[model samples]
Target: MEPDVLGLVAGALTTIAFVPQVLRILRTRSAHDISWLLFGILAVGSAMWLWYGVRVNSLPLVVTNVITLTLQLSIFGLKWRYGRGKRP
Candidate 1:
């Protein structure tokens, strides 16, 4: 496949991969097993990717990282709210 098409497909798959987890968390209303550190690092890394994408003018990277960052931040917020209690 062409590079742009490949990038978009890859981006779409990776971007949507977080959906199930987000939906699960929302349905369960619990993020007890979620790792804050992991999500924090991911959010930061996604932000960096977004910045790099802008600098490099890669549309795939920009769009992918934007959506990824949004999802990661949402998970982060959910974790913060639902993970407040002790882990069991």
Candidate 2:
């Protein structure tokens, strides 16, 4: 390995890790198991990371955080739409 390759691998793993939760929520239309507050925090954090990436010109960081932000936002939307009033 190259550093760029390592970054890509890490980025892929971290970003794709959220896929299962997103898929489950989409398929089952249930986001009761996920915390909305947590997702909101994650979205904000990811946005910050994206900003950092842009400032630092780190392609891996920018790409990964962008994808993660999208996925997390999707989860937040689903939770708001379907998990409203549900506690878990």
Candidate 3:
């Protein structure tokens, strides 16, 4: 298979992986179990990956990292806002 194809496949899988967590958080309006350590690492890592993707001009990497970054930031925010407080 082509390298780009592989990258796209990998990117798609990883990017979509965040969907469930995000959805659950949104649905339940709770993030009690979510940790800052996990989301923090992910946010920073995704930002770095996004930079790397831009530097290397990899479309799959750039697209997925951008999306992943957004999702991660949202989760981070949710973690801070709802992870500790009682559910509403």
Tens digit per residue, CA lDDT, model 3, 1-88: 8988999899989899999999999998789888788889989999999999999999989988999999999898878877775445
Best by lDDT: 1
Clashing pairs in 2: none
The full ranking of all candidates by TM-score, starting with the best, is 1, 2, 3
Candidate 1: TM-score? 0.91
Which is better, 1 or 2, measured by lDDT?
Answer: 1
Model 2: lowest-lDDT 10 consecutive positions: 79-88
What value does the lDDT take at residue 26 in candidate 2? 86
Candidate 2, residue 72: lDDT: 95
Off by over 4 Å in 1: none
Please, what are the lDDT tens digits per residue for candidate 2 over residues 1-88?
Answer: 9877888789999888899999998899887778877888989999999999999989889988989999998888888887877565
TM-score of 3: 0.86
Deviation from native of the Cα of residue 1 in model 2, angstroms: 2.3
TM-scores of all candidate predictions against the true structure: 0.91, 0.90, 0.86
